[model samples]
Target: MSQQSSKPEAPKSGGWIKPAVEYGPIVLFFISYKIWGLMPATAVLVAASVAATIVGYLRAGRLPWAPIITTAIVVVFGLLTLIFHDDTFIKMKPTVVYTLFAATLWGGLLLKKPLMERLMGTSLKMDHAGWRKLEARFALFCAGMAVLNEVVWRTQTENFWVNFKFGSIFLTFLFMATQLPMIKRHMLPDPAESESKGAAGE
Candidate 1:
């Protein structure tokens, strides 16, 4: 009889669509802001974020809750920016969103939830210690982003902050790329390999 593998199958990568899923909304918002200023750009951002979420769900067969949560914040802040006629609310979106993410990650660690594993366990096969390490580091990264966003929007000119926001997508992706080594170092043993070693009595 055939047997199922011990782990869930990793989900499909969603191919080239993944970049558009992640960055298209932000790029559109940047362009809109360049042409139309904050109010119209806020509207564009809110719509683009919603569209991205829908496209992501269609591609992956599941909603990406991480971005959904971020988009929700954008919706609220964007609405405020429109209603109140102040860009400050939208400007604060990144800080609040990143702070919430950091808090959730650290809180999950405190409660022993392994939240990162729950979200990525299928795609990432790693030991418990590895999961915990990745979780803590990601939490720290979020916290750092929150502080950085706050500093930029508060101290910098609007043009400077907008440029920084656009630039940050690449920085964030680069940071993720740098984590590949750590992920490789901490990979779990393949079940087939483990079984082979067992059969060999090694």
Candidate 2:
């Protein structure tokens, strides 16, 4: 059987496209909130999330599970918000999604699946042990995000929570960047080069 490559290349399309698609809905939601307030913004968020999901699947030929799940929750809670005429449902969406992510990642680690390895392996190329460690850290981060969202939405204003959502994206990017050194340390050496060196040494 042929072994799969540890490092897989990203799609040939522009790298910026992925981030644009991922964040487009959130940006739209933020803008809608600023202009029309929370109710209209919630509607816009649901619509934008649907559009983003459709665009993402069309580009990649597969829906990314995390965004899809979050989108679904947004739709659900969004509908509830409209039905009850209460913003609480929409505000709770982030907390729910973040908690789900934390539980899912930690559960995967316990099951020996290590979700980060599956999700990021294409770009990161870390060994199993490294994947486990990364997964654990990510789980903790997700949990922290969940707690932070809960605290903010409950104790702060709607506008503050909205800003937090936007600012948290950058925080997450920084966290991911910080892990590069660890990922580099645990990456597997190139098999072809290793074999060549061994042959040369003999």
Q: 123-197, model 2: which lDDT tens digit per residue?
A: 557799999988898888889999998999999998999999878888788888988888788898887899999
Estimate, for each residue in 1-202, the C-alpha lDDT of model 1 and write its tens digit.
1235422232444544456666787899899989998788889999998888887777666765687888788899999999999999999999998899999999989998879999888778998888888889889988998899889999999989888888889888887898888888999889989999999996
Q: Candidate 1: worst 10 consecutive residues by lDDT?
A: 1-10
Clashing pairs in 2: none
Each model's total of backbone clashes: 0, 0
Q: In model 1, what is the error at residue 48, expressed in angstroms?
A: 0.5
Candidate 1 lDDT for residue 105? 91
Candidate 1 regions exceeding 4 Å error are: 1-10, 13-18, 193-202
> Candidate 2 at 29: error in angstroms?
0.8
Q: For candidate 1, what is the lDDT?
A: 0.84
